[model samples]
Structure formats: structure tokens, C-alpha cells
Target: MSFRKRSEVVNTRGPGLQNARGPTQDSIQNARGIPANTRGMPVNARSPVPARGPQLNTSRGRNVPSLNNNNPSFRGRLSQRMSNMNINDDSNSHLNNHPGIRPSPATSQLTTSTGCNDLDSLLGHMGLPLGNSLLIEEIGTTDFNSVLCKLFASQGIIHNRLKNGNSQQESNTHVIVLSLNKMWGKELPGTYKGSKKDIKKQNIANEQSKISVSNLNEQSSTPSRYKDLKIAWRYGLKDEIGQKNSKSTNQDSTEYKDYNHQFDITSRLIPTPTSDEITYIPTNIPVSSILTQLTNAIDKNPTKLIRIIIPSLMHPSMYSPNYFKLTEIIPLLHGIKSIIKQNESRCVLLASCFTNLLQSSISSSKLLLNQIQSIFDSIVLLEPFQQEMIQLLEKSYKTQPNKIQHGLIHILKLPAFSEKGEMCVSRSEYAFRNGRKNFEIEEWGIPVEDVEEDENKDNNVDSSASNIGNPNNKPKKSTKVDLEF
Candidate 1:
């Protein structure tokens, strides 16, 4: 028996074995051409795994998965489960804290005063809701809306200072001002001193505290009424007294204070060198960089509340008349909305835009403004106060003669989550004025002429009585007041 070298020998005993070898050789021959370009590759190299579905060999087509396919891998399933788990956990935690905070569809439950009580009353949230944007839209060419923006900024500053115990040092919050141009800095609203109403309320609360202290002392000295005291010395009478004393001391030392202020638009906020509370950013900065800088500033002070005041959002100086045409506005607003939601606990945004700018744009692109407006939590349109309405308001309210009438506060939209979010409510109209010391919003009342009509009827009877009492009952001739040349 002669045995050949193992590499050269080919075993063929049964026909079945030869049949298997025939198929193997054919498969080898089919794969050999695939790696022809892959020089130095081993002939015994493993074949590529087959694709799940039949594939076409189109030159431009890629070997991607089918469009309507599911990822059934273990890793994919695990990631999906993790995302669902996280969502459920977040929902459960939010529901747990639901009692403490009321959820708003349009705005956050948290709110800060607009610094003007009347304006607060007009808003559904009773103030500027946090984590929401307040849009101030003006119809005409007046800087009155700017005054509201200033007041909003000033209030935040004042509240921050007051929160820090009115310290002359640094404040506890940040005020970011996106000024349309250089003029806004010179005209920033000033911090308001306590108004007469604020002072009066403070005094009343103080008086009540004193009275309560006196009453507590009197009660302590009167002695316990229970005669069946099992442990007069050990019944915790001493502990109770000590607890009360400690509570009183704590109350006295750290009384809660309200930081809501009434801002004065006529004066400028006195910039203190040490207190860098207000940060001014030029509106001309690139839209992409705006949010980045804002994020950096906010992160710098993680614990501080943030107030962003954007005045004249699309002013001609900062942007072209056709600025909305640029795609940047959409992303900019979306980014801002995201930021506000992320920091809803301590962030508030107040922005103003002139309606005329949108109106003058091509009618087809008008929806851009609406889309922008929709992103905001609330919208307030300031129409030029009707001259007749202003006169009527002036006559009815009898405000100071020198007070310049502001604008009509038309609440176009209220925060969806607010207490009274209805937009159909009657006479949501309000008249605002820039007084010497304050910016005020008041209910727009019916004209005084109507009220005078009833008074005139009463006066007719008085006139008849006067005539009856006097000897001259004859009516006086009508006198023409108009003089013609």
C-alpha cells in the first residue's frame, strides 16, 4: 500500500462523500472571485454573513436595512426599555409634587410680579409666570412699550437686591438685558422705593406682630387652667414655653419679606460698580451665540434666579426689515423656549416686538410672527390707546393732570395653565399711563358722559326745587358759546 502526502491526497470512498465534495468545491469557486481584489487574503477566509433580505446589486444603491424594519437586537431593546423607564419615573415624581405646584399648560406654576400690580392683575397667572415668555406687541411708533420692559427689568433687579437683604454688595440674581441698541442702557428703569401702599401694609403687619407678641406673653403669665396636671413640672409645660420662646425669637429675627416693587420708569437704575446684577448684550450679536452666552452666564451662578429682558426684538437697527426671512429666528425662539423650560424653577423671559413691523412684511410671510408668538407662554398686544377712550379714562379716573397716557393693554393670550385662562372674558381692556414716579395699568371704564347722564337727571330735580324756592321761576334764555368771525 502506497500512501500519498496529506496535502495532495483526496479521500473518495463512497459516492455520497464525492457528492458533498462536489458542492463544497462549487461554493469555494463562487467565493474565490469576491476576494480577488483583496490581495494577500487567505483562501480559507470565512464568508460574509448573509443579509436578512434579498439584496439588489444596483451601482448607486446602498446595502442599508429596509425602510419598514424593526431593530430586534438585544442592545436596541435594552435602550428602549431604559428610555421608557426614565419617562415613567419622571411622570411619577412630577405627579407626587403636583400638590405643591399647580401645572400650567402654557406657563410654569411659578410666577414673579411684573412690578406693577395692575399689570399682574391683567395676566392670568396674576404675574409674569416663570418658564414662560411674555410678548409685548406694540401697534404704533411709541416707546411706551419699552417703558414696560424697563419696569420689568428694574423690578427683577430690585427684587434680587431685596432678596439679598438690600445689601450694598453683590445681588443674588442675574438680569440679562438684550438691548436693541445703545439707547436702552441710558434709559433703564430705576429701583423703586416702597410705595405708600407698600409702607402701609408693612406697618399694619408690624403692628399686628407686636399685638400678637403681647397677647402671647399675657397668655403665658396667666398660668395653665388644667387642675388635674399629672406632671406640672414634668408635663412639658417648661418645654412648651421654651418652644414658643424660640419660635418667637426666630420669627422676630427672620421675618418673611415681600420683594415685589413698583418700578420708576422716569429714572435710571443707579449702576453700582460692585453689584453686577444687570448684564447688557447687544441685539446685533449672532442669534446662535446669544443662547450660548446666556447659558454660560446662567451656569456661572447656578443658585441665582435669571431674568431676561428682550426689548424691540426685531428693531430695524439690530436687524433688517426683512429679518424674519432668515431661518435663524425660528431656531432662536425654539432654543429660548427650551432654555426657559429647562430652568423654569428660576427663569423668566420678557420680550417686546412692534406689530407694525410684522404688518409691513409681505402678507405671505405674516404667519412667521404668529409662529413666533405661539412659542411664548403669554401674549399682550399694546394698541395705541384710542384718543376717545383715553379722554374717557382720564375723565373717569381723574388721574394726575401731567400723567402721559400710555397704551391699551389688550391681553391677546393668557397663560394656558393660569387660574382664569379664558380669552373671551368681557372688557379685558385696561388703560396704562407712564406717571412721573410709576407705570400704572388700570381698568378701562365707561366714559364719564354716561355717568354724567344720570347725574344730569338728578340735577334737573334740584333745579326745579331751586326754582320753587326762588321768586324767579322763569327759564333763562339759551346763550350761544360759539363765536364766528
Candidate 2:
């Protein structure tokens, strides 16, 4: 069966998965919507038989939680179950029995006009709940943005298919891009524009991939960085600073170092002086008009899985100000969550922090943590693993086993199903709620013990400079000389 190409056309019949997953996994669909294209959700079909596994027989001698920590009676039963099932890393325990995971009364599937049955299977139910937010907070950048974009794209695809009165299985899903950094052009959340540079700069072989760097400073007042006025203003600022203040000590030097001056792009954003020089967008944004297009998409796809990924490649500080906390991003986030629900798709909202944030002192109103939290259904702080926290997740799941029932099938579901199929994966998915409340950075500066001398030196230097400027021709001598030297 033929499908509509990118130009857009409607077709009433054919197999959907065959196109994306190659001809093998393809299943034919008649006049109705078909299955396939299920990138985000999990396949819940009860396998008629256990899938084959290698002969490592790795199931035996499982580290089974220690007796000290695990209740003996429960542990005996749990151990017996584990022995019977023999869960390994490769094998999924869905086929096995569990006393804890009971089906919800609302477990029925939501039917869609879209022909894709796989989408439903992957999503468990047809859609995500209203106000449900999936936050993936991690330090590493691997596959983070890509996976998120796909999730958002998949959601949008389903929504569009339903909107068209056709099955998503039967039609093509298009998540128009609003703006971004590092997205592949193939599908979901649309294409990724490497950098927002002009065509000339884009041609440069070594031009930095925007996603590789992170911006720490994103302004709240402005919308688009590429705007002409913003760019011009930024250029002027840089020129002025280079000439006059390059050697001068900055008042906020402490704050700058707190972020480690992360311009090297190891884990954060690069600072851009003006809005227009936002030559890179690590978000893989599909559209050129970053700000306006994103706002528009948010308005359009409340029920779709729309991802506005501000990758860690950009300077965190550079982008944070324009992020949800800075502007009216609440409406956009609400729209995003709403659209996913309306369209019967799930939404994943991921925000990455840069070195700037780490470098900055912890202060109220700066992180805007609470405001950002309200935008999401759940939050995950993906950083280095802590053993105590892991233990907590395990304990919580044992007592409240049903907490992550739907999560069992979701691949990225935090605290995923333990390797054994028993509830083991710690869904510290709500990382913020479960995360450390007080995380601070320590850096030695001029200790307070030496503060008096330093202050005296600073005052003396300032006074001398003032005197140098007042010799009748102070404007010429102290006129902030544009040091040609």
C-alpha cells in the first residue's frame, strides 16, 4: 500500500509500520487505521510464549534484597517467585505473575480513528492524563534530546491523525518545528537545525553543533534571540565591554565563577551578549522562528506530546531567562500537557541545567524551581546516583507497589521494572520531590579573614584611578580609554 509523501495527501488504506520499521514487522491494515510507528509506548501484547534468552542462566543467585532489609516472610515468597520466573536483563517479566500489579478499573484502552494499533499498545492506554508531566532531569546529554523529541513527535502525530478524522496508523504524523538545536531530520518533533547561523556560517565545516554547548543565561524579557534589534544591542555591548571593561573586574565575578565560566561547553551554555547572536539552538527546533513558532505550537498541540527541548549544549543562563520561568511559559506548558491529553498522547518536558546554574549561588527567585515545577506533571533530577536514595525508592515501591503500575510498560518509566520483573526500578521520576533539598557548591575565594586588606586595596586602587582622571584633562586620561594597546 502507498503512503502520503511529505507534501501531504490523504490515503484511506495500508500498513503503517512497514514504512518505518522495515518490511518485516509490518502488518497490513484494511480501510481502517493500522499499527506500527509506536516509538514512545511499550508493546503490552501478552506474549503467547516466553521469548528465548541466552544460556547464561543468569537468573540464579540473584542478589535478592538482603534479609536485614527485606522482611523474611515476604522475602521467602518473593525469592520463590523470582526463582520460578528467572528474570534476566534481556527478558521482560510482563508474562510472569505478580501479586502486586493489579489491573486498574480504568485499564481499558481508548479507541482511536487512527489505524495504528501499535501506538495504543505502546502508550498502554490511548492517552496521557490531564496535567501529567514527564520530566527527565539528567546531567549526561546522551540520547536525552533525541528521545524527548521522538516522544513529543509521536504524541503530535497521534493528535494530528485524530484531528484529521483519520487513524494515526493510516496517516503520517507531523510535529512542525518551532525552534531547536540538535534534531535529526527524519521524524518526530520535526527536523533539527544544527545552528541558527546564517547560511554562510552554516556552511562552515567546524561550526559548533548547538546541542554540544549549553547556555546558562536566557533572558526573561525577550522572546527571540535572532531578532535584529536584540542582535544589534548584543553586538554593541560586546564591543563596548571588550574595549572598556575587558580588564576591569566585574561586580558579579563571584557569581560567574560559581558557574565555572562553562563556555568550554562540557556541560552548559555559552553566553551570547545580544539576542540576535543565538547562532545555535540545541533544542532541534523545527521552525526558524524560534519564539513565535514555539508559542503557536504550544497553543495548537495541547493534547500532543510537544517537546520544547533546550538542550544542555546551550548556555543554561543564556536560555533560562527565556525559558518557562522567565516568560509566560506556564501557558505554553499547560498547553503542552493539555494537548497531549486531548490528543490521547503522552508529553515529556525536559529542561537541562548548565554550569552557570551550578556556579551561581543558591538564592530565592533565581532558580524559579517552583514555577518550573508547576509546568510539569512530574520531575526527575538525573544526576549522579546516591545509594541512600536508591534504597528509598526500593522501600517505597514495596509498600506502595501499585504506584507505578502504568509505568511498568513505559520504557523510560523511572524506577523501571526491576531486572527481575519484581518492582525494583526506582522511579525517582519525581526527582525534585525525592531529591536533596539543599545542594550547595564550595569554592575558596579571598577568605573573610583577608577581606579587610582586599577591600582597602580595592578602595585605594579606585581612589587612585579617580585621581588620575581628575587632572583637568580627566576625560582624556580617565575617559575610559579605548585601550588600543
Candidate that scores best on TM-score: 1
**Candidate 1 accuracy as lDDT:** 0.66
Which runs of model 1 end up more than 4 angstroms from their true locations? 1-108, 163-170, 180-183, 194-256, 272-275, 391-406, 416-428, 450-485
Task: For residues 174-240, write the lDDT of model 2, one tens digit per residue.
Answer: 3343234323223333222333474455664334333332221322344333333543678755665
Each model's backbone clash number: 1, 67
Error in Å for residue 76 of model 2: 73
Q: Candidate 1 lDDT, tens digit per residue, 196-229? A: 8988877865664575777577557765334225
What are the C-alpha RMSDs, in order, of all predicted structures? 16.0, 33.3
Give the 10-residue window scoring lowest on summed lDDT in candidate 2: 259-268
The local distance difference test score of each candidate is 0.66, 0.36
Candidate 2's C-alpha runs over 4 A off are: 1-131, 140-169, 176-178, 186-362, 365-367, 384-485
